[model samples]
Target: MTDRFYSVIYTLSGFAIAPMLVLAQSPVILTGVVEDESGAAVAGAKIALVQQISSQTEETTSGETGSFRFEDLSPGNYLLKAEASGFDPYEEVLTIRSQETKPFTIKLKVGSVKAQVTVTLDDEDEVSTSESNTSSMRISNDLLGALPTDAEDVVPLLDRFIFPGARSAEGTAILVDGVEVAEMDMPSAAISRIRINRNPYSAAYQSPGTGRVEVSTKRGHRSHYEGSLAIYARNSLFDARNAFAKSTPDSDRRLVQAKFGGPLPGRRSSFNVAAERLMNNESAVVNALTLSGPFTMNVPTHERRYRTFTRVQWWPTELHTLYATYDFKDKSRENDKLGGFNLPEQGIRTSEFGHRATLRDTVLFSRNVRNELFFTFQKEEQRSGSPATAPAILVKEAFTGGPSQSFGREKKETFDLADTLTRARGRHSFVFGGRFR
Candidate 1:
């Protein structure tokens, strides 16, 4: 009976310690340090581990020192991934062995992230960590396809949201490739990006960036050619008539845009061209009372616009570059401001044309010093006149008008010269710029 009791006690003890033996045999750990290419620690990096066999995923973030550890992992093939802001993602296949500790060092490269001081290491082995304090929103080419930018009238939709504080277009500043412009005349396909509210405090701008829109154009490829054509059309096929109109007003709108870019024979020079044509027509309901009787009619309004942009980029040397661009626009409209209480005879016709030419030169003096010079010339002429010579008359809310007051003529010519120099030292950047118009 004593021998039987000893055997039973030994079996019970073995059973209770079996789980601890099993757990102690599978001690696997993974450790890593996340760093940038400059050897600076990348804090708050996301680290993920996936087991190949069990398909289990484990996620953790790096500590302030950029160190991460995963303890008590099962021995298997795993996919290790690390990612951080402003840096490219990292991935590696790790084979973990039982009762082993594996250590790794992950070095991430800089990506397309924009910063005030980019990838500059000082003599003290310190990296530039200060970033822009302003908030900015960017719309790339992928998003521009869905926006209502095919028509001139619809372009204001973005202004209403982007520059809500601006009272008018003149109050908001527009920049194209670091150069101030009165308008964006290039085709949508040629546009690469549109950024709002970027660098509000820089002295390079005449006004703050809080009410600014910056446009960047697509660059020409050195090895291949690219082109795109876009056509947008609309018509009043299924429409409801206005409550005051007898039938649905005839409406039609069409837009065609084409863009092409290619490198020159030497590949050191490139050119890009874009052209657009727009035609729009709409019927305006005229409800008015005249000396003869109540007059009601549908007046057709017509608008036509043509715009073209051409740019040539030449690289004289590895450190020096030049850009020349020309833009032209022509517009005509019939029956302007002739709706509602205004009669057909009160319609106004408008015609306008504009030309813009710009030249830019860039020189890189050193790794942290740069200079840029810009010259631009713009000319515009516009005129508006009523179709009828008769003067307009008003009857205090009652419809009475022989001619509209939308007649004006203006011509403007502007020349601008600007220069800027930038120098980055340690964690500070100094910019000196001046503009003359």
Candidate 2:
């Protein structure tokens, strides 16, 4: 019985140690050289390799030959930054693969380092070697908050910010956290940043004619909580009367928004939730060419909208991240585009419901290669026409009438799964991915 117990213990130990042995055997190497524009080596240049997932940093200095190397690195994505005296700072994304040797040569241009140069992933000033030109704009959360918007909707804000000539007639492609989304219904209070890429030539994106709009949501911090509330109101009573109207046009608009976010109890998890409601009541205007239509006409209009968003994030390890998000919206409008006579038949009532959900996983396979896998599902439903209980009435061009149709409905659903892999080989960076819907 003692010998049998010893064999069982040995088997358990072997199972635990096998993975460690496998990881130790397949280390990679990263090598690079820093040189000047005049083909001269720049010695003593400071270099840093920051792992993208874990945020672990490794530093070294270039030798007399301007050569630097990092050995025994696992596969994953990293940010490589180099700084030297009398040269502009340089940074680029690097991907390393297991059991591979990657090499790079960085040419430093003549510039003042004290000027505080920064190279970001989406720097507008930097022209990528692979692409001819890129036009892009980034809107920060602070700027977004300062801008006035209705019902916390981001679509109108985007339309106002993008140049009229640059706007796409077909509509802009929207992406949230690198995943394509069908609509731009996310509330402004939940967004951390908005990036508009006009006429981007990157192979990674398949966008519409106008370009792409990328939105990133805020991730709550550990052990911290934040919340905000906003209320806006507008009334026609405060406005000056128009020359054509007999009395002040009846108009009222009210919007309320709330957002809250904080860390979960334990295990490096966080959650955020946001909700908004908007109500608008106004008098519709009619332009009638009829000789008997000189009198004033006031048609009551009403619109109501509600939206909510929730997100949860879990960081199981330094090199792994998981997140899930859900978004919902309901909107209804009444008395739209009624006839000049304000007849019920001309009125159109519409209601819409939208839902979106996403599940994502981000992992660092090594110091040089990173992978992002995501699954998304979306659904939308729309209804138009008068209420079923309302009586149908019909009349000729003379005057009053009710809608003939009681209801019309439409629904759409979509599902998508995507995988992206990034690999670095010396001076070249490669990105390849596949998506299914």
Candidate 3:
């Protein structure tokens, strides 16, 4: 029995040590340099190496020094390939051994000529390559899809991305597709990306870009139809009672957003449309001490908002394109400020309606020259009223009475036009534009 026990322990220990021995095996290192037929270093050359047995591939690009390295490779046969623009492809097979370091030299010859063309417009195709002086945060569609659609406002979602104390007293500047707007008029589903520019000081905008938020809307697909609908809802039945409320006040919020995009009837033309509806009804707990004694109640409040946006794109010629967009918004709120120490009579009702229209044209004059022109018109109307006409009354740390002090009507109209020209020469790019509002 003792001999059998010792034999079993030895077998079990060997099983444990076998894996460690395998894991301790040394890795292979493959390093190489790419060069042209003239023996000149070929920078930015693409390098691909594949393990024949595993069919696994690894890729890298040659640096300015024309050197590349791949580490931790297993011992195997590999197919090596290198490619670069204006150069012929190079291929070879390499056999690597464990714990071995191997070096290779690859040479590429000039390839046949190929025709390629690309069109770029002012601001629309601007690409940034430097990250020294600017920082930006982007919120893509995938991130937006994870957020609650029933959210009452976008500010709460945006606050986290802005730099500390970056917003000015006047608030951040909002630009939708290079056009400044008073507010976002499209649903979240219609937004392609939301970007925050932390170091915007360019002259293109009316305000500095330091606290600017740029929003780009999705474009219609020219070939296929795409559509989506999202609905969000929450009721009081699933919510816990508020600490100050007498009971679980009846409250509910519902939101619906739908968007569709597809090709239009004409060639090279497309259209995108989106709409949203939100209805929110909630109760606010009020705990106050009045002349009659303690006054406690739940004040019911409601809000409704509607928004619609439509965009059309048409290509009159191969080098010229036109875009038009229209947006409408309507919102109303009842008992806006009737909670806390203020009584229901002090509640305020407010309504707002707005319409915005825009037209843009982009023309490519040459391979290196482009021009863009755009115009926008907007009209906004607002009205608010109070239930009681008396002046407001307040007792420190106690109660408040009388009507809300906010009551007014206002109307405003805006007209904006801008034109820009861009020219690129070699590595340098020049841009010129002016705005009228």
Candidate 4:
């Protein structure tokens, strides 16, 4: 009976100590030291460890030697953070493995309280009053979404958003990613931000005195696919008649836009495409009671516009990026005089086509320096004419109009190469750039 009792007691002891042995064999130790920028030990530094999977946190304070240790930790990922008085916080990510010991050194920089000094640059610092005084406005993506827009075009939107005193649709220079674009052809859906610099004095701008419109497009980093479609229409049925007109003027306007963007599979690439079309028609009658009464003379006009844009981007590494973009636009307008007595056949037709292609590369030489190189090629053609075969329209008591012919055509091609380098040193940042056109 005593022998049996001894066997049972030994079995119970073995079962009780098995877990302790298993845990002891898988020991993990994490040791770290906290030091200031001067390499002096920082005692009383608070250290915290956060397990990634379990989200458990353990806290400890450094000893007199500025050393802290965590032993018998389970193997897992952890976030280690150190904090001390009058010093910036330090944080690092580390992994703990079973039966492994690792050591870390945490260096804390002096807090801003230690040195309270503000340095400003004339051209680069926004708060520097010595530079040319100008007001700037930023249009955020949230605001853009809240604002109403008729189509994907931003020119009209910008004109309406800017203050009345600062509004200048033609004088404002449009820039995309710091590059001047001939026109605002990018879709609104793809725009990430817009900045309006009123009365800017920066030499980098094309016409700083007039103003500048800077636009940034989305990079499509967060989403795998994104697209939007919009359609707008207006007709005379919902319009009010003018007091001078005999009847309501006939008018119709329509717009359609589509935009899509997403990341490509593999190689860290992305692409974006946008297309838009607009059509407008209007007919109006001039009331001349003394001449011939209502409908004596009529004017009709029609306009059509088509635009498309595409962009592709690739990131070969963390320090390098490349971009290619293409834009195309076609527009045509026709004006005719009709429904007038003894009126000759007359009309004016105008058409324009524009194309632009750009390539850009961005490289980060170091944490403090960056370089950007870009090339752009643009082509534009315009034609306007009143055919010789058509006769000029005439109005009673106005003047005798004869056959008239006029033709004009213009074509332009431009190429630009530019590079910009930016470097930041102690208390100063420098930007140097040049462009060849």
> Per-model C-alpha lDDT, please?
0.78, 0.77, 0.81, 0.73
The lDDT ranking, best first, is: 3, 1, 2, 4
Better of 3 and 4 by lDDT: 3
Better of 2 and 3 by TM-score: 3
Off by over 4 Å in 2: 1-134, 160-169, 208-210, 287-295, 339-344, 386-408
| Clashes found in each candidate (C-alpha, N, C closer than 3 A) | 0, 9, 0, 0
Per-residue lDDT tens digits of candidate 2, residues 121-217? 2111111221333567788899988777655666866866555665556667677877877677866778888887766656665543456777888
Arranged by TM-score with the best first, the candidates are 3, 1, 2, 4
What is the TM-score of each predicted model, taking all chains together? 0.68, 0.64, 0.72, 0.62
Per-residue alpha-carbon lDDT of candidate 4 for residues 1-437, written as tens digits (9 for 90 to 100): 99999999999999999987887668688897888988999999999999989999999999998999987688888999999999888888988876567578889898776566543211112211113345767887789867776544557778654455554556567778667776777556667778777656555555545566777776654248988898889899988876755677788889887888888888488888878888988774544433344334446778888988888888787677888888888998876343333233345578999998988888778767878787999999998875577555446654324454557899999999998887879866577888899
Model 3, 150: alpha-carbon shift in Å? Answer: 5.4
Better of 1 and 2 by TM-score: 1
Candidate 1 least-lDDT 10 residues: 121-130
lDDT of 3 by residue, 1-437 (tens): 99999999999999999987786576778898999988999999999999898889999999897899998888879999999999989999988876556578999999988888676443234222212335777777788777663453565667566776667676776777767787776777777777777667666566664477777777798899999998888899988878887788888999988999999987589888989999999887788889999898988899999998888888887788888988899999988877788877777889999999989888889988878888999999999984456678999888888877887899999999999887889976688888888
TM-score of 1: 0.68
Model 1 local distance difference test score: 0.78
Q: Is candidate 1 or candidate 3 better by lDDT?
A: 3
lDDT of 1 by residue, 1-437 (tens): 99999999999999999987896676687898999988988899999999988889999999999999998788778999998988888899988876566578989989886568443312111111112434557677788777765483324655755646542447556778778887776666667777766335555566644466777776677678989888888898877768888888889999898999999989988888888898999888988777778778889999999988888888877677788888888999999888778888777889989999989888878888878888999999999984456667876555758777677889999999988887889977787888889
Model 1 residue 319 distance off true place after TM-score fit, in angstroms: 2.8
Residue 109 local lDDT, model 1 = 89
